[model samples]
Target: MPNIKSAIKRVKKNETLNAQNTKAKSAMRTAVKKADTAALNNDENAKELIKTAIQQVEKAASKGLIHKNAASRKKSQLMKKA
Candidate 1:
């Protein structure tokens, strides 16, 4: 409901960005969960999951979707449990 034309455009752009970020975050969480479960169960796929999860986390951090410290913390925890 932006009155200004630029504001309306910005709102549209923001909505698209929000959707993309939400998808990325959701995928990251799912990857992390898979890594955690695999680690706990000693599954053979755990290594792959951990690798992919770490990559996803780093990507998110690099994109500014998540904080660097949080990314490092997640990677550390993921590594620790694996």
Candidate 2:
């Protein structure tokens, strides 16, 4: 409950950004899970899955949704698994 009008608007904008960031993080996690599963199962498409997952991680980092080091670490681990 912001008393000032500008504060109220800022709060609304923060909520919207939070929701969008949550969605992006969830999608990134799902992509990583899929890539890990594909790798563990020794699927022929594991390479492609890993590539997509890495791309998603990079995009999230670039958008400031996640940390750059975290993104690089995830990509490294996924590539190692592949």
Candidate 3:
């Protein structure tokens, strides 16, 4: 609980931003996992899934949710698996 009005507003903003960040991160991880599984299963749609996963990783990195190097590593790993 924040006593000051500005502090209360800041807390609300922080909460919303945190939720958004969490959602984005979760989506990115899910996309990566889906791609990995598809690749391992030898699915025809694996290429498309890998592409989408790379895009999600790049988006997350651009948004500062993840580091650029980490995003690159994830992309590399996905491609390697595929």
Candidate 4:
């Protein structure tokens, strides 16, 4: 619905960014969930999963997808679960 050329371009850019952010956030959540479940199940690979989850959380935080404090809290929870 953007009649102006710049507005249309902005809309397109925003859509692309939103999609990327959604994907990153989803991946972060999935990684955290997997780590949590593995920890609860006493899986041998739980440590590795936790490591991966922490990395994902950090990545999200660095990208400004989540607050630094929130990332720290998530990392803490994952450690506790592990």
- TM-score per candidate, chains pooled: 0.97, 0.93, 0.97, 0.98
Scored against the true structure, residue 24 in model 1 reaches a CA lDDT of 99
Per-residue lDDT tens digits for candidate 2, residues 20-75, read 99999999999999999999999999999999999999999999988999999999
Off-target runs (Cα >4 Å) in candidate 2 are: none
**Tens-digit lDDT string for candidate 3 (48-67):** 99999999999999999999
C-alpha RMSD (angstroms) for model 4: 0.5
Please give the distance, in angstroms, between residue 70's alpha carbon in candidate 2 and its true position after superposition.
Answer: 1.1
Per-residue lDDT of candidate 4, residues 36-75 (tens digit): 9999999999999999999999999999999999999999
Q: List the residue pairs that clash in candidate 4.
A: none
Off by over 4 Å in 1: none
Candidate 4 regions with alpha-carbon error over 4 angstroms: none
Report the poorest 10 consecutive residues by lDDT, candidate 4: 73-82
TM-score of 2: 0.93
